[model samples]
Target: GPGCVLGLFTNRFFVLRGYDMKTYDRLNRILILLVILSFVMAIPAFAQTPSSDPDEKAYEEAKQDAMGICPPIFLRDENGNTINPVSRVNADVPYSPKQTCGKCHDYDKITQGYHFNQGKGEKMTKNFAQTYPWCTSPGQYGGRW
Candidate 1:
């Protein structure tokens, strides 16, 4: 019922029925003790260091490797061809972005992305321009026409 009175103590809420002062006081103390016991049980979990988690350690190592802080592995194609991103089709050899990078990864979706659409006629949103006007400014390195 909307008329029920709620008793709050130590971040917990409990309903008080029948205006029994003794029962309410007893329930309040029980709830407080339960909260304290829960916190005590969680102490060992909180004390555990970040290095104790193998997943976290692995993620940190991967991040370092990706950021070039750690050595990078040379990737090769299925046919033992050294994967070189710089290789491009020469004159009279017709090549597209999809034809190039698509051999190893999906380049079609990447080409349609915002970063690759730099010189394209895609209009920058007003919010984007307001947030990062340098991207649209003429003198900046990433400036669009």
Candidate 2:
């Protein structure tokens, strides 16, 4: 009945009926304790494994579909939105070039490749600069022999 007060404790709701003040107080305390215990015992859910969980599996498949190139291992947040998505699984240095990546690629590739070969000289292609893996603005170079 709607008038019946049921308490959800220990993962189940029990009707607190026919109990005196002392008994009701004891039950209330027990209920509070059980809730606290359950909360304390709870572990931080990590979306389980991509195999064991159906949702994660679906997300993994969706990600694989969304990403045509090599897929990087990223994490799904609590809201089920993907966050901190990285690029590929191997070394990111080649893609995120700091001082290297040019060691093997060289100036010819950098200057003549899709990034700088448009005859813009100092001006860069906005699209290329934004999409190109590693971005280096001109006049930002200080390399010398």
Query: Against the true structure, whose TM-score is highest?
Result: 1
Clashes of 1: 0
Model 2 weakest 10-residue run by lDDT: 91-100
Model 2 TM-score is 0.22
Question: Model 1: clashing residue pairs?
Answer: none
TM-score of each: 0.27, 0.22
RMSD in order of candidates: 14.9, 17.6
Off by over 4 Å in 2: 1-18, 46-145
Candidate 2: Cα lDDT at 121: 46
lDDT of 1 by residue, 32-137 (tens): 7788899999999998777878999999988988778534443445343455556632333333434445665676777667666654655667887787766753
Summarize candidate 2's per-residue lDDT along 21-98 as a digit string, tens digits.
555556667777777877767744543444878998899888888787544443433333334425533422222332
| Per-model CA lDDT versus the true structure | 0.57, 0.48
